[model samples]
Target: MSNADSSTKKFASQADLEAKKTSFIKLSDNAYAYTAEGDPNSGVIIGDDSVMVIDTTATPLMAKDLIRNIRSVTDKPIKYVVLSHYHAVRVLGASAYFDEGAQQVIASRGTYEMIVERGAQDMQSEIERFPRLFSGVESVPGLTWPTMVFEKEMTIFMGKLEVRLTHIGMGHTKGDTIAWIPSQKICFSGDLVEYEAAAYTGDAQLEEWPATLEALRAMQAEKLVPGRGPALLTPAQVNQGLDYTKDFVTTLLQSAKESVAAGMTLKQAMAHTRKVMDPKFGHVFIYEHCLPFDVTRAVDEAQGIKHPRIWTAARDQEMWHGLQAG
Candidate 1:
């Protein structure tokens, strides 16, 4: 595909991407999810005297929609902005929240380290890969900095409401987390649980991802706002979303394993996995953008490679070529 077609394939056009601000659904009396038309999800929790936001959108301009939605509800000052991981698409709009008087921006220790180590590289790579998502690219100052960092788990109370944030291991990334509201059995599952969209595993810990999902399942969330797709209301829909994500991970790893057993190259292994996964999950958002990277990482992991290597712009183009040929 030409670069123009490639760009269109990956990024949703600004005109095509409609941000539908939904009325806040009360997970409990204090917690709510301010979801758009699946552009990028942000969470809202009205604490005892403050409000906490989960995951700012891709750009500050895009985040204004979230801010507008927040205005519709209580006027509590946004006290905290919690990042589920370190991806720019999720955290770049953080400054917008801070402008509204957010007290501290929180992220896991691993995510904090990632911003220090590979943030610039990731910013360049993702911008070149998906232009439309980063509509106001020139406006982003740099990686969003996390003011507060945690090791494993942290608990905070908004008056009587209890909110638990836990780092559930290296699933989607080294510092993946899910915000749990115990009183309502609701979870703001970041990229750890994709409803219909393809889980981007470029920076994932494959062996540990399944166990992390299992841990999330044990939470028994009645309502969940996943990393992508609509809010899962029923228990059955939640289970289906979890199972679908698991299936994607399982299929990629198993295909890579079979290819390794047959002495196939990484390119060959990726082709095999795509052939297998497309029939099952071809229509999800960013499926093409994610699959090649997912297979490459899975193959490396299957061959006993522990850590995922950093992806530069050069590496992305090289992998895209290899996958497209198949």
Candidate 2:
């Protein structure tokens, strides 16, 4: 079947789209994280004077659920909303936060630039790639632009709460950042740490992923809100999340490198990878959506490509066909 046909098969029905809603999981005192049935995760921190929301879902309509969840806990205004990365599914919902009186929407300098350069393209690609996540596409006003951009790291004080935004290194994306609460030992790892989910590495720096995880380990977090899956409540579970992420990246890179060294096509590489990864990570969230893209990008990077190619709708179709053909 053609890629266009695959698109029809993948998203012809919006059954999955109808299931997105906010799930309030309390991480600590005066702190909670909002996760949809499986949408992008958002965090809420209620300080002495105001509030800070970590990530906004994908659309204003989707963010209303997060807003409603926050209202249940406190009436304090959302003073800040932090973007963990530049992915449209994560930041496009910033407008909802703005209406809630969020004083600043923060991201790293590289992430800010990415939003300007490729955010629109990414927005289009992702909407098609994961239709369920962008349920109310019309609700998105425009590309999500960051108001406050940081370089290496920035610590913002919301009343007495210290929210340390740190650029540990490039892993998931060029400008990946994590929100670390030193006192509580809780780290809101963007896509850097995934729990029970496949790590999406289309724009990932696979070589640098292990080191980024190492930097995260050095922080000794007792609790963490990973990019996906359930929140890690214990240090052991946090470490498990980090380890699983590292293992997936490492194995993917190995499969790609080996397949390319023997002159195999991207499809053959994916098949080999599927054989190796199925018993372990095939059950993870988005494992199928992420693996083909992950392995395809890894093969290109292993063949000496420096930067990841821009993912357009046409390219997505092409890649989808390649996967289906195999």
Candidate 3:
């Protein structure tokens, strides 16, 4: 396909310019979810002494609205910023929390390492791929570094409430973290689980993803705030989210493995994956946008490429043209 056709179709989310209505659903007396339709979702944990913000939006400007929503309910000082992962879309808005007097930024040690390695490239690549999501990219101060890093697990106390942040194996990314409230039976799963949305597996650990989901199930969280989609309030909805994400990962990896076994090229593998996955996940948000990247990573993993290739802006177009070409 020519650049004209590619420009129109590649990263076509710019055409999706309609604003999404944001919702702040109270999951528990101390926990709330700041979800905007299918956009990246954030979780709020209100503590007796202060508050904790999970997965700051995309930019400070965008986060100001979330802060406003938080203020609408409680004026507690925003004391903590918990990064579920190191994705730019998730952690870039951290400055807003800091400005609100956030005491410390928290993340898994692996996430901190990821931020130092390919964070810049991922930031540029993601912004270019989904301009609408980063509505105010200009407000992003810089790479968001974590103030506190934990190894395996860390239990934080927000007064009497305990917020357990654990590096729950690897699924979405190597540094995937989840915030669990044992008393409330609520968990804030980062990109490890996405509800009613396409699971972006561009940098995922596909082989280990299912096992990670099993660990989440072992929690039996009654309520969940997924990375995207609305908050899952009921046990059935939470299970649905977990099952949907697991199905997506397993199917993609299995298809890619089959393609590799048949000695199919990346382009052919993309087609094979589409035939199987599109029928089921085609209607989900960003399905078209995510498939190419997801298949590329799966193919690499199947071929024994352990680490995900860094996605630069230029590489994104090259891959899109290769996959979407007529």
Candidate 4:
């Protein structure tokens, strides 16, 4: 069906009103994953004397649920709030952890710079796109700024547990960060790896994504908590999650490159992508929601746009309608 079809047309950032059932899974002795169906995920690392929250939900009000889960098992103070990346849905709820004894809000230097560059625009853009995810948006004080920013990788000790947070390379976003616990052989890969859900590529670096995924694979994580989907509790599952993400991104970019080589318009490229990906990924969560943006970004990269263009609410509509019109 054409994007103009009223009945089947799904807007880029439209609403999915159904509340996703959340899963709070223990990946290891110290690590846990909070995932909602196919919505974004947050990771928890309980250290010796304190705890760390990987990504906050959307707003302070929404983060209460995750905090409750953390409180159930351990009463340790929430010492660090790590932004897997600077996306609004992932980082905006950081304020909620301060009362839990949070001392530092952590992110990569790349992520911090992105917040400075487009955090405001992305805030409006995301709230408008995924309205339900941000129903508690009013509770957000403002953009979440990281207090501790790292360049390559930094290690934290939870008593004797060695937890390392690293920025291997850019995949989902330029500043994507991952948490690794060496003792447990567990990795909390932010949005870099998705198991059953489509990876959001609106702000992604398409060309470099695969190599970044490979870097994650080299970790040999025995357990992994991906950005979405259920928590992976085994090495086999970890490899599966990695492969699924790599396949999706590589296929999307290749389709875009082929379309560009043949001089296909954006709309035509969308059609081409659907023909190849639909049979494989059509039924996955948010595939419809993410495909257009994925194709748009992939096409841009193929045409030599290295840095992803900043997305604003106004630009969101323009691009949505632009795709629909043709």
Candidate 5:
């Protein structure tokens, strides 16, 4: 097959310019979800005297929309911003919250370390791949640094409400954090759990990802606000989201393992993966854009590269071109 027709299928989401309608749904009395179709999602927890935002939108301008929604209900101080992970799309919008009187930005130690290590490169890489998501990229002050960093787990009392933030194993990234409400049984599971969307496992622990999903399953969260797609309002919907994410990651890893064992090239492996992953997750949001990165990382893991390689814009282009040319 020709490279233009085969390798250059153009999964670059820059072509994805259509605007998506944003939704603000109240999952419960204290919990709400700010989602825009399949774009990045944010979680809101209105405590007795304050508001806690989980995963700020991509930029301050984008965050303004969320702020408007927050104002629609409560004008309490936006006191806390919790990062689901260190991905630029999720954390970069944190500065906007600070303008709303955000007192603290919270994240896992791993996420903090990741930011110190490769946050700049990751931020540039992400912004290049999907410019539409970063609607106000120029407004990003810089890499978001968490003021409050925790280890395995940390609990914050939003008055009587108990918001538990935990480093729930490694699926999406080293510092995958989830904000859980014990009283309401609601969870804000960053990219670790995406409903009807592709999980970007480029910075993932492929071998251990499934187990992490299992750990999240043990939470038994009745309502879940995933990183993308609609909120999983019911326990059954939560299960489906977990299942979808687990299936997506496992399929990529298993396929990469097969391709590597057969000594197939990266481009060849992507094709091999499509046979299985496409049939199941082909129609999901960002599937085409994420597949190559996911497959490449899976291949590295299969070859015993435990830590995921940093993805820079140049490297991304090289990989994309190589995959397409082959």
Candidate 6:
């Protein structure tokens, strides 16, 4: 690629400079969502005696602001830090909770394995890809290791409220987990669902994702705190988020399958996928940053590559330049 073409903007999210104001929305009496425009979101679940945080922000410094928000609502200690998956942007800030007296960091077995396998590489890759999101990267001490891990599901109670954490099939990643409160019909879906923003599918299980959405819908959640976008407070809004995410995943995978069937190259598949998806999702946040990665994964899945390759900072540039140059 030419020097001008290989500028920072060509890499994923390198040129994104806008600052987004954070929103702390109450989804129910016990559940809340911390969203920032279209950035990754964190969920707060407050029970009678303690609190459980779902997905810490990108760094310890960023999580401090979330802690301040939690203090505004309840003084209960943050007893648990639940990771939805092992993404750097999602789990790196976990130590901040431990500093604030969080008793344990929790995740699924698959997520724990991912951390052991690719945590370091993903951290470096993400920090370079989205500089603004990792504004406090220096504050991240190291990989956030989970103190507790479950197989399929586990339930915990804080005073009267019961929080259900389940490995609801894989979508965004192989170890996707969701926090569900049965009594309130509320769920904290990590990266499994994105409302208005683009779904980052670089590490996704595309074929299994739609069925996972069905599993999420079966909960009949009245309130949902999605991974990105504003909190869904009503049942209708919750359905909309699920449907939008399903459509995005379905469309991308379908386009990629067709490209593969026609024996198209990766760059050609990406172009074709964009031609189909841009009209609908182009206006969404991080659509440009997400599509290249999304299509690359879709193409891989279509060609029978079940697991996504690890993305290092160097691999990210190579892929971007190769795809964009073609």
Q: Please provide TM-scores, in order, for all candidate models, with all chains considered together.
A: 0.91, 0.94, 0.97, 0.97, 0.97, 0.97
Please, what are the lDDT tens digits per residue for candidate 5 over residues 1-326? 23345535444576788889999999988999999899999999999989999999999989999999999999899999999899999988889898899999999999999999999999999998988999979999999999999999999998888899999898899999999999889999999999888889999998888899899999899999998999998999999999998888888999999999999999899999999999998898888788889889999999999989999999888888878784
TM-score of 6: 0.97
Which lDDT value does model 5 have at 237? Answer: 97
Evaluated against the true structure, the overall lDDT of model 2 is 0.83
Q: Each candidate's root-mean-square deviation in Å?
A: 2.9, 2.3, 1.8, 1.6, 1.8, 1.8
The residue-by-residue lDDT of candidate 1 on 1-326, one tens digit each, is 33234434332222344334544565667767765544456678888888888898888887787788777877888888999998888888888887888889899898898888888888888777766677676767778998889999999887788888889778889999788889888889888888778888888888888888898888888888888777788788889888988998888888988999899987778767878899998887667667777888888888998877888878887776665453
**Rank by lDDT, descending?**
6, 5, 3, 4, 2, 1
Point out the worst 10-residue segment of candidate 2 by lDDT.
8-17
**Per-residue lDDT for 20-54 in model 2, tens only?**
44679999876787765445677788888888877
The residue-by-residue lDDT of candidate 3 on 146-239, one tens digit each, is: 9999998999899999989999899999999999999989999989999888999998989999999999999999999999998999999999
Best by lDDT: 6
Q: How accurate locally, in lDDT, is each candidate?
A: 0.80, 0.83, 0.91, 0.90, 0.91, 0.92
Weakest ten-residue segment in model 4 by summed lDDT: 1-10
Candidate 2, residue 117: the lDDT equals 78
Candidate 5 lDDT trough over 10 residues, lowest sum: 1-10
Give the better candidate number (1 or 3) by TM-score: 3
Count clashing residue pairs in model 3. Answer: 0
- Clashing residue pairs, backbone N/CA/C < 3 A, model 4: none
Off by over 4 Å in 4: 1-3, 6-13
State each candidate's clash count: 1, 0, 0, 0, 1, 0
Count residue pairs with overlapping backbones in model 1.
1
Off by over 4 Å in 3: 1-9
Q: Write the per-residue lDDT of candidate 6 for residues 1-326, one digit (tens) a residue.
A: 23246444456477787878998888878988999999999999999999999999999999999999999999999999999999999998998888777998999998998999999999999999899998778999999999999999999998999999999899999999999999999999999999899999999999999999999999899999989999998999999999999999999999999999999988899889989899999899988888888988899999999989898989888788778665
